[model samples]
Target: MVECGAKHLIYVSRSAGKSKDDENFLHELQVHGCRTQTFAEDVADSSLIKKVVQNAAKPIAGVIQMSMILKVQGTWNLHNAIPGKDLDFFVLFSSLSGILGQIGQVNYAAANTFLKAFVQYRYSLGLPASVLDISAMADIGYVSNRPSVLAQLRCAGMQMLKEPDVLDALRLAILRSLPTPSAAYETTSTMATGFHSVSNPAHLATAVATDTSILDDEETSGELLAIQIGKQLLTFMLSTESEEELDLGRAPSDMGVDFLVSIEIRNSWRQSFRSEITVLGILNAHSLKDLGKMAAKNLKEKFERRNEAMK
Candidate 1:
């Protein structure tokens, strides 16, 4: 995209292997007669991030970065550095895991949650920069593969939990407790279709009942609206599949897990922004055991039905 007269860009990633990949990227760009500057740094390392931002060329028109394990505040700090005069836009790559916490990635969920909050904060600040959170498919590459003794232990505990249909009973009870409520109101143009207002449970409960009143008197700019619409579309397109399909057990080096993308907007003035947080991966042997038991029970039921039909 840069080769076609795209003058300014910022690319951020946590992959240690980016240096090697960057060399190839630079070479390709050079072949196209495009001169560009690239910085490779870790988001978790504050010093490195500061250095990278300070080194950016003057008149910076755009900033693009991906926040993985790093906290949302860290990414917001980077965006804050882009001079208002030089910065025309800021794009943030967030993750679905940040929105919907992963089974074993609580730390990741925390970071992402912060990111969502940061995006709203940025809007409240009234900065010229617009934040976009592009929710993309999970990169199977980042999943861990090593199975430790702890994992085995947890799997065992899961077995006990599942004994005598206890697990199924718990699942049914939880499902039964789910509330079915709806309300309607004016929503942010950037908000995706399934994006719920966990912060306002009451409002969400009656969301379907309320009618959205479009405010013609208050019009948002085309650029801002475009950014919001684009992000919403991208998020919907990217998060269409089940999280299980991404196979989080694998690591970043694996072929199946390549890369994922998302966007976030940060407005410090309002303290509302997009934050993605993840929990540390914990493999409980008991949980696994219970899952296994449930699977076995399901299979047994299927077998019994088949036998009854034969009879």
Candidate 2:
């Protein structure tokens, strides 16, 4: 909307603080002839919300609610204060974690789930409500602040949303219109609403499936391939330069592999070998040799289980 020659734009946030990058963002909008003003108010505060609305630019066209607390009651307060239902489009930035509960984040999942349901509720009221259950965004937003968390997410098979795709998705969401026929929007969907993972949409489902093990011998091949996969994963984890000169005898910690790197390895191992090696197991290994042995053990267990089931 900024580039489309919008006359007045009102930005409501908790504070008027601007990082150098944020200032650049506002400047770019102004350069595009979009007169922008920032309002400092807590959206969850009923009085503050009303005050902001009363002081807002005339004819509010849309609302994109992205703020929510990490805990239950606090989140509920914010959700209740979500305004502008009578507007053209209301986009709720939810998360896939709501659908597939994340560890130590029960309150967060519940809160996001509420937002997802709110979209449907608005739809029932004949409002333009869209919920985007987005995954990690690489360069911007909350995920970018903690890159280690992002690495862990990658290990868990979460793909990061690229900037271009995100921009396209946002354009679709806010406009609530059919995608334009352009090279930039070629891959984006016309019906890019409801539940969507910015990266892999089917990933959560795949992770949730019960049929995890490659029970058939033909499917996973055998012990030799499993060993190769283990070695390859360890190589990828510990080596900064190349996988050629892997020090299998050296401990991962000694080789400068940290807890997060070990997580990446564990996730890779799970995906490649269809093994159920915990991150703890990966970290517990004294050396690369020990890690390989753990992987081998997991493979052996799967084979044994499949054989026993057959019997």
Best by TM-score: 2
Clashes in each model (backbone N, CA, C under 3 Å)? 82, 0
lDDT against the true structure, per candidate, is 0.38, 0.56
RMSD of 2: 15.6
Worst 10 residues of 2 by lDDT: 185-194
Q: Which candidate is the best by lDDT?
A: 2
Alpha carbon lDDT at 61, candidate 1: 61
Model 1 CA deviation exceeding 4 Å by range: 8-19, 128-311
What tens-digit string does per-residue lDDT give for candidate 2 at 275-294?
67776766566766666555
TM-scores for all candidates?
Answer: 0.42, 0.53
* Tens digit per residue, CA lDDT, model 1, 169-249: 222222222122223322132222223222221221132122121111112111122223233323434546442243322
RMSD of 1: 21.1
